[model samples]
Target: MDAEIGYLTPGRTRRRSIARTIFAGSIGNTVEWFDWTIYTVFAIYFSNQFFPSQDTTVALLATFSVFAIGFFMRPLGGWLIGTFSDRHGRRSALTLSILLMAVPSLVIALLPTYSQIGVFAPILLVLARMTQGLSVGGEYGAATTFLTESAPAKRRGFYGSFLFLSIALGLLIASGIAWVLTNNLNRTQMELFGWRIPFLIGGLASLIGLWLRRNVDETQAYKDMANKGEIPKRSLRWIWRHHRPAVLRLIGTSVLPAFSFYLFVSYLPIYAIQRGGATPEVAFRASTVSIAIFMCALPFFGRFSDRFGRKPQLIAFACAYLFFLYPVVNSVGSGFWSVLLVECFGLLAYGLYASIAPAMMAELFNTEVRAVGIGAFYNVVIALLGGTTPYLMAWLQSINLESWFLVYVCAGAAISLYSFIEMPETRGKTLD
Candidate 1:
């Protein structure tokens, strides 16, 4: 780590320069989500190709179970990489994680199917997912913190929304890739070779993202901390001792957004193709369209929070989301227009939470423990709410209680709503 640094007074950059930094921070996040969400979309096809076990459904369940494991590994990724980020620089951490994810995706793309390698294929699948998981786990904290810090104070909330917008873009790419492969390839082709295209695309994007990130400046906030040698060596301890309330607050606040986001992007396709009598191609098309709109809407809400404060935006979204959980989900069975109508509203509400989360979470702590505190808390909630949600929905479906599953999602939003109502706003406030 170089000790050389300089002072940066607030509000001192060209608009284009600031936009570049935000884009750089955002692209890597976009690539990460591309690879991550691609795994889920393609799993429907490749789970059978790679993991041919007793039952395809059961194998997919197990595969996704391991998929959830990747998320579980994220806290460690956050703690280790985040500590390095807090101690050294967020740029370094962000760069390393992007490359970490790229390599695994490429390798997984090239791996042989079950017929060629037997059980070793899925084992390799699990191993690759774990590696990607570790990278993404660290990537979120580092990148989110980087963008929040790099963003101008007046626009931090809106700029931090870049994190989710990029995530939505990544998901869009994943859906597009899946759609192309499924539509263009014959069943034989998809099962054998077509499935690799998305992973290859993801890996290549990650590399390009790595190059883009190199041009961005180290965050001025982290630079100042380094100049003074004031970074906490044990940020986890500080968070545990001084910031536990904030951590708990973040976990509760994170649940509704996390749940709804995953429900829309991660599980909805599964529901459509498997339960709603839609083809894979149809499901991907609907989801792709919905995500494109969601991505575009993020910046609007992101900027909205900056003007309106975080709490009210979150509260309004929470109430609307709880009301729509079951109705929107069930309405999707009606066909293209209906699915789009339902998902658009659902994802729009979700965008409110996702867009502001990175900035709001960063605000919960001073720069000292910002990374680890956000990482651990966010990962724990995602573990409970996001990682298990599809499985939970699947379980509910098995019990003939699909409507009851809506209750689970609505309940999560209510928890976050109450949490949001009480959580203080940090709009335009500087973190020291």
Candidate 2:
């Protein structure tokens, strides 16, 4: 670690600079996820606004289709922004991604409903989600790269956990907002206008995230690579040619976390409310508390990974999921308290994967093409799996095979378990 070449500061100044970088990077990442998770949180309420229908399930299906559409756009975002991050800089790429997200949130907040504009409402809503999907795709790569590269090798797991913690915080905030609106507004009022409030707030919050991200310093690893003129002529090409194994492994290992995250955390409220017959107020309230616990627990797992190792923690998560998936899904049928308990326990299992996964992925690639490598592989898997969890669950339920959804999640965890077994321990290892 060359202090002069890294933070462009030494001693206390460098430490302060690192802290600022973490805050700036993590906040923008949080906002990106906040914007994303809010769509799911409010979809049950706003489905009628965009796709008016007699059948509530039909309207929800349409809304979730658009949500999945946003995910399909992520790989493109990953390709564009990942290249930009590798070529230009992580700070610039991250700031641009946040800027892209802000516009969509604002549009969704103020856009006309189906009653006012007919089918164009859903069309525009889909367009907004497309833009957001792209933003989120790029945000992960830049944010993770920046966070991992900014920290000391020994503390990388601890620092990288903030990225996932931010995700939990984003979801927690979305759930809290949802709970507040549901508690205050009756169902009709929520359908009428209450759903727009969180989107408006998210849009405004994006501006603050953009401001914070603008001030973030470039990561030392990136700085060093740039100074040495090690940037690839085509970063993605380099990744494909030289790092295909790592990319494939990333896709494999990412399946469990991505699928489980979308299914367990993002889709929990919907599952609880729709299938379990829990009230929206009860569901959102439980989500808020459970996710808060998840967020707070992330740093502890990260620190633990720093002391122990990445593979073992991930292994623990996978084994837990493999064994508990059925029971967890079964318990949700018992009502709100049961759903709450399952979700809270699920978060602990998820923490093992979320808190340290970024550090492990970051360790797999050198700085020159790290962003592109991560963005492409991770986003593609998420696009194919994570983004479609809700839609898949809905379809499964429609077909009277909803139990298979749990089995599907378990299969992903099995794949991830094998990957974890194969993965080298990355704790205390310097970024390549």
Candidate 3:
């Protein structure tokens, strides 16, 4: 571990360099999440274009089903890209992930509607989403590994928080675009063409992300591992044989965070409109404000973890979710201010987990298997739980059982709370 730490220079110059590197590393993540998120944000407008149904609910269910289908591809993405990141380098993996995301976004932007393409439209949409899912699965592992590895030892949590910060930025941008489009265009215009604009923007933005990631330095940890010939030949097999406990712990720790993230950040606005009786503009506006608050709070929470410990922050998040998620969900239709307040409150608590997740997860393994360890199991769990969140919520609402989804989220929180309790504190630890 000391040898690994030796690879990173500690100085003012290095500190200055770290900021640029973190931004460069995180920009691709922003684009990756932006591409991934716009699908959900615009689903209401575009659901009819691909899945024509007399019942809007059925069309949305179909749309969210495609969303869930895309998630099923995440594990495969995690495995393939995680292994690639382990073998090649984080920079290569990051670049590859962005390229994968860009093409799919462009494809979705350009594809014809069902009216023009018949049954092929939805099929094409599904294929595009699956490819983007793969990109995101890879993006999380690689970006987490890169950002955590690149930070100064004592400041890993503070730097690592940028991972989710970028995600929030992506969500903000997606929601902001959705708000602008919805406010500017009529229903027909949004359904016909406005929904495609975000995808086009995301696709073009990927070029900037690509160029940024391409120029950033590869992490010192990866460099040290390469110099020492520590790169694993088969990351997944090695992880199962040697580090099974760590991977399981990671999955457990992630359960609530993943579920809560989609529930609050991605699906909440939709819930407001469909279940809670809010308008699209109200939901989007509220969502945007809440997300901004969430994004702003991340760095402070992350820096706090650096001072305190990872476990306390994570435990706080789980307990907050377990106790408060029901009321938060119940507040969905209450009014604009109530919705905004709950969204901010819930996401602020969630910031406790989001801010330190990358560093904590990175501390679970050595550099060789770090990316893959997180990629393989983490992506699978997210696929099963996180990816299905919006679909499950929609399904529950359809049956007048939306409350059950709250129970489901709390159950996940309980599991995560237990996991956080059992896990050791990893603050100020050296990367191996």
What local lDDT does model 2 show for residue 389?
Answer: 77
Sort order, lDDT high to low: 3, 2, 1
lDDT digits (tens) for residues 7-49 of candidate 2: 5656668678777877887998778888998898789989988
Error of 3 at 76 (Å): 1.1
Model 1 weakest lDDT span, ten residues long = 1-10
- Candidate 1 regions exceeding 4 Å error are 1-13, 112-120, 267-284, 327-333
The regions of model 3 sitting more than 4 angstroms off are 1-16, 48-60, 114-120, 266-281, 327-333
Better of 1 and 2 by TM-score: 1
How far residue 226's Cα lies from its native spot in candidate 3, in Å, is: 0.9
Clashes of each: 0, 0, 0
Clashing pairs in 2: none
Q: How close is candidate 1 to the true structure, as a TM-score?
A: 0.90
